[model samples]
Target chain A: MPNCRTVVPFSGTPEQEQKLREVIARYKGTQGPLMPILHEAQDIYGYLPEEVQATISEELDIPLAEIYGVSTFYSRFSLNPKGEVKVSVCLGTACYVKGAADVLAEVEAQLGCKAGSVTSDGKFSIDADRCVGACGLAPIMIVNGDVYGHMTVDRVAGILDSYRGEVE
Target chain B: MSENMINLKIDGVSVEVPAGSTVLQAALAAGVRIPTLCYMKDANELGSCRICVVEIKGGRGLAAACVYPAADGMEVFTNTEKVRASRRQTLELILSNHRMECPTCERNGDCELRRLAADMGIDSIRYEVEDLEPQLDESAPHLVRDNSKCILCRRCVAVCRKNQQVGVISAADRGFATHIESAFGRGLGEVSCVYCGQCVAACPTGALTLKRSIDAVRAAIDDPSKHVVVVPAPAVRVGLGDRFGMPVGESVQGKMVAALRRLGFDKVFDVDWAADVTIMEEGTELVGRIKAGEKMPMFTSCCPGWIKYMEHYHADMLDNLSSCRSPQQMMGGLVKTYYAEREGIAPEDIVVVSIMPCTAKKFEVSREEQRLENGCMPVDYSLTTRELSDMIAGAGIMFGLLPDEAFDPVLGDSTGAAVIFGASGGVMEAALRTAAVVLAGDDADVPLVFEDVRGMEGVKEAEYEVGGVKLRTCTVSGLANAEKVIRAMEAGEAAYDFIEVMACPGGCVNGAGQPMHSPFERMMTDVKGERAAGLYALDDSMPRRRSHENPEVKALYAEYLGEPCGHKAHHILHTEYVPRDTYNV
Candidate 1:
């Protein structure tokens, strides 16, 4: 796929780097530690930045190319920073047939960012999920924890509005 | 006959292969041909391309012969109508995404995909897809990546990761969008790539290719003001003939020189002379270290790829690397300095072009340190064996019919030790031939042939006593083997006084720039070994077998450079290395 996700600048703290080193040390020699370590790293930094990947590669002696390959193959792994308010539009066959593309377009227009990328302000991000196991709720739009089913082009802004300008 | 053997029927022919043999192996043993795309013998058997599919009697579906195991009493039909259709459909699907401009491709005549398509009677791509915008990555000095032509066979990826242990490229994304890329899609120059060109060698299509220096060399030759000189690496002699359809091991040294002379070179020198010079300097360094009992394990510095690898990955061991410049650069240094001064020509006016059986030499000649004291680079241009052949073809020269010719005077003559430098364990052997004599005071009984370290093995180790001093040495080709030796040294599990590391497996004879061989040819014969044998035979036939005994090199030292590793020689023939950040980002 063309890399549509804009590269979010690395703003990780020294504490995060230290925590990652400790986690890598813990799982250094264990079996198949890449996935678990990457999981914990994503939890710590909310993304897999080049700096983080370089650290993991050096610590584990694994090629960064392989790590990046794995990071890009799975959908759960993000190479960019997560937005303060996560917005997901299910683009599964059931939902896509129900005008989910229009709903996704509306969200992109409102957030000023394409799917798989964070907003410039870091307040919102749009993700086109394959399936959230909510085909019954065709054309579903989920913002944070609230699932807005039977979503339309007009409802995208309202759903995204509830989480906008809110401090974490 | 053997307990581990299994019997199977392939294309109605009874075959007996090992129990764990794949269907592909069974078919080959049964004299049946099963076409494959992504299968590269032991290196890669991914079976991602279903072109090698075959039908099994009483089986549910057709299975990929490359990955399918051959069971006892199994009946396989490789030419079934269903299997043929599946192979054709798979080829068509693969061709759909590929940009089909084969006329201008480097692999036009030898592309595996095109050959397969033609074999299967596929006249056209039935399911052509819209071509994606072409991604051309020419960021590195040695090679280029044209993603538009990549078939995603992963042969390059497999070679890079498994054989070289420099996993710089891998498959990224999923399905239709999947493509091979370096980490985070950075250019190869931005990563820790040694630029060995193994990827280009492994690639079955024109997706990867050598960054050509033929045009630049031609430009220099065409410039009347520039006095262009050419030198072919030792391996180039053995490797060049393959490009012209000669046998793999055929040595075309004399004809190669004739071709170069015909191409309008002011002088056609030899890198072998420089190799002899390298032994003088590197051997001195090794002996000095051994006598002082410091930096016990000294690594050979002849390979540019190995040097870059050491600079990027094993920076801690930088002290252990020999400070001698590679033979190519040494030849360049001498041509621009010694030859220029002797002939009353300006160093700036002399353009030294080296024809090498390697891509890394292209990068090597461009190093800032490779520049001479007069601010002129030793080698102006470095072209690969393939590029040399292309130049000869472009000039309309019938290479096979060319007359044998001799190299020019002064720096052209070399010894047998220098000629053998084309093979994997050759540098060590060459150095030993000279160093043993020096250590034993030139009168002691020292064996000339160190047979223990001679072969195509990944790693070879031997111990010998010279001048009553026990010397432990290790020779390794392929970076993966080098890594194992280094890791062992770091863990205190192994120790050595001298080490030779060549990045390409089987050394320059099988260098990435040598020639493109069909996958079938590569699997059926030991091409590298045959080329190495040619070098060994040439070495055996030479009048002088020791580097120290080279009359021309002796004259060079006596007249110009003075002593081995002396003040003047060190200044011109040696260089230093600095650690580089693995990821440029």
Candidate 2:
């Protein structure tokens, strides 16, 4: 968990909170609705804060233990907030063999953050993916849902700078 | 619904079991033994451990006999070379990762994993352990969790979730990184745990165990300045003998008192005396609630686990809980007060040690309300039957060879109703024995044996008319069932005059701190029923079967307490409940 001093206070609006509650209300009595509720919760809030999790726990009458367990199990769920420009580098078998590790390292260096960490300004974040199904574009990267195939270590700085400039 | 029986052959012997029964059940009926680690009869059927694997003809591979259902004319080979080899390999694999500190382990002799290894002739482990860092969670007062000895069988998880309805324990992380833990790196003490110790009982190894108080108890025993009086709950008599190699559910009452006397207790008293006293307070409260017609379904507050559960989860229904202290706590408080006054010993000089068939009593002793005005704990050291047995063995007392003896007089006299407090629905039955007379007249025509509340149903409900008042009652064992009934009551569905809840499935006899039943004992025998029979038999033979009829109890009220619900009784015998946080904040 990020320290309280560093974590941005929950600035989610009433509409967002209402939307989250509606998502929970829709799946109220469904057997094991935690997964779907969490999905919509992530959509409305962008990430799960302690308060959001607590709200779900109270609303669904489910133990926080079960909710936290399900949240931490899957890789898709993010407890931390996503950055304005999210970067993904595919580390699938083909890309890994094509030197995706070096590409990820260069990308991490440019962002000044490790994989799965958001930059302090909240403008950029880095993550390594298992497969983007772009093995033919072995050593691929994506920024803001736009694919940048056939990436290289030397080209990492300019690519990060381009997203950083755009977000700022 | 004709009794459907399916025939199968195991080890060349014909076996017939009810349809939908597992092959393990069929093999058991055929008198063939199959070793199991993760299987706890009705509670756990995960079959994660492959120790119970058996060769099924024409099957793809050796099937886990615990989960595989028996089919007509199916041939099962339990002890063939291939089956034995597979079972042996599974044991060896478990042994490779398990910390083999058997000699010094808490469950050295009784551990199922160690026993299976020996039975399968696992001479050596061929694989190396990864040396996972052991996390010893002694944060809770009653239980300790050691990851070193855990085999990851998930039996503790099942018991906590399925039986207790408290899923604080779950598989965290995955695979080699996986272990049973509370939510978000919290200790059991940090969660809403009632410290019932059911998971400790369900554990096959030393991974989970009672946080032993043997050394502290021994120090108190050795100090001549301290007067350490010992009280044994009635359930201990039926359970203690099993540790001494006697038959399960055998009442060793006289022998147990003798054993305690030999262990150097200043006075060996009976908690049954206090149990009788509990009936007086709880029964009066029930009658009072019925008279008021509020909090109609008065809940029995004897089981500390059930009490804490309600305090945490069902705070809204806290009014329904009886203000009476449990028999164990009542005994402790009275020993410090009334018994101290009678013997002319200063209350501070007396150290009350209780031998119980419960783990929750250890936590109950330290409950803030049970303490005295001087902040002295009423019960100084609450030891489990296992802990007491260990103490006896440590003191080199030959329990079986000792001659039978009687408890010390003043606090020892008890009626038969007191003894049955060890069984499920026993408190309700015991209270009814006295409540009938109190409600009607002295010679109220109430049946002695209430077969309605007898036996091991999860919840048993009954109604009777006493003095033209219809008494509706229900007895629930196991927290899951208790939760269900409480939820129903919240919905205005279940209405009754009295309700009893015991945290363990069959009450104190099946308590988590009691002896772990062997696989055969777990499968074939009604261990709960047998122990209950011993108490019921004592009730049948005793001169007085009702709590109110006990001459000693009458003398106690006359000499000290004055009356059942009097000020003195309320001060010493009653306690208030508090609403607790549902989650660790």
Candidate 3:
């Protein structure tokens, strides 16, 4: 029954602390407002780390368990930090039937990381996804939210190269 | 009839529909069927199919009529030249990498893709079909996955991850070669999947299908040396009628039993009998633990999906699960051991077949630990509701002409309470029926119905003051809700004296192994709810609705077993869950 203030202590720059306070004020005394605040914070900061979750929990006077529950419940929210470039591979049924496995393998090899893992250099974060509904363009990959259609194993390196030059 | 309505023009025809209706609804009201593949009503509206695209005047581009809202003064064209071309092209693109073996496919005539192509008059593919070899994943016992015919509509993924809350398979790679795969490309059997088969129900194509056990059952029947016995699950009575084009919730128990007899089975029994026995065993276990103050929250073990979830993710809590095998498994064990001895048949010669409403029953039948005597698996084959329907049709039996008959006297009699086990919260209610009687010491007939734990809510809870002792109980349907309940319990946010969990929402009636329906079509009717009502109504009409009233179950105790928790009953009807870390990723 302990509140979020008991779980998280105040630890951030004065400006960052003020920004957290402003975010908390927007959702103060509102029903189920923690999810929306977390969403907005993740939208601004690219991810919801433990520190950020704790800060939000303390500011909103909610339990950290409740905050963690909200984050894990929804598919849109992610806990880990995302790299500058987000690489998402399509694993929709159509693409899977068409050989998305090869595309995934090639991308994993080139990036030197598995799906749902971020690159050591912090340049790219790779992840596989459910259908984005572009089955007509089977074996599709999306990098930084830009859809790449009809991808092949040979074409994955080029797609990664294009993102490498542009990202960071 | 004085409600306000909206008038809209679709494909040059004027139609009137409700104000909040979508353009798809408006068009349907005009008798204009807009072609669609991935727009199953409220179940799936991801608009991933792109086949329902219709040209809307003043709109940016072709819009999916299913999800796009209908506004006043809007002009909609259902089958414009551009619309037809776009739909045809989209289908052609889907076919480019698809395996076109429609003649031999299971869903040959009933397939949505084939029907759409025929409706669109697509005779040949314009693009070169990719040479991506098809993958036939037979790792799971109850379901088969063929990725070649997949269109990636993601209806299956949406239902599994969002609706069922079991993330077994997901979209894995990006563009042109994108495919749905199990986590880390591991076999589905290795994952924490409940095997609820919601993905099978959500799939629009033949990619996901119930693994038919008909051949194995048929082989058993044909073998003169084997005595094949059949046990029909509680939900099968209500669902089997749908295969005969009967209205949702029709009780076809008589027909099902008669059909099994005609199919050359030596004996046709009811899982309901074992369900009663399960209540006896599980109910006693609950009381013993409660009396001894051991394992405060005893979870129901009838649901194979929930058991698999515990085995994979929550292995540490395995001891908390009720040690009763599902009614299907219980029936199988009894038929092979007790019945085999009584009938003078060798244990190996007695083949037990279960006709179930779930796909997960297949996994339960073949579980390594399920073998009872001399390493012999109790249930030989588990046929899904759909597979059973196919077998009935394959035998050329005139179902409509068949008279409704009763199940055999031995193990065939069941109570109305046992029948409700097909739907969500059923196990909890069934257990409560016997628990109340046992707690009263001489069976209290008062308060037969536990209304709090009934309904379609994801999670439900109630406190029962039975015999002056407060018992906190919780029931969760759907794996996601179960996860929430477990997390709450682990975090000390919630406490329950007992819990019942089913992986599929609405229980076996809405199982993954049931028939697949378009979401748009389901939006037009309350199919799942109606099916559930059918089971509940059947329960109400039965004269023997309490588990303890089952004469066969009483005989089970008198003949073979001394008491519910007797050593003999525990050896056969009960088992344990094992922890596994098979998530390769």
Candidates 1 onward: DockQ, in order: 0.55, 0.23, 0.04
| Among all candidates shown, the one with the greatest lDDT | 1
Better of 1 and 2 by lDDT: 1
- Output DockQ, candidate 1: 0.55
Backbone clash tally (model 1): 0
User: Candidate 1 — which residues are off by over 4 angstroms?
Assistant: A1-6, A85-87, A98-114, A119-121, A132-168
Quote the lDDT for B450 in model 3.
86
Better of 1 and 3 by DockQ: 1
User: Which 10 successive residues of model 2 chain B have the least lDDT summed?
Assistant: B171-180
Least well predicted 10-residue stretch by lDDT in candidate 2 chain A: A1-10
Q: TM-scores, in order shown?
A: 0.94, 0.89, 0.76
Give the higher-DockQ candidate: 1 or 2: 1
Per-residue lDDT for B470-554 in model 3, tens only?
Answer: 7899988888889889999999999998998888887787776665556655666666677878888888888877788788888
Candidate whose TM-score is highest: 1
Candidate 3 CAPRI assessment class: incorrect
User: Against the unseen true structure, what C-alpha lDDT does each candidate score?
Assistant: 0.89, 0.85, 0.79
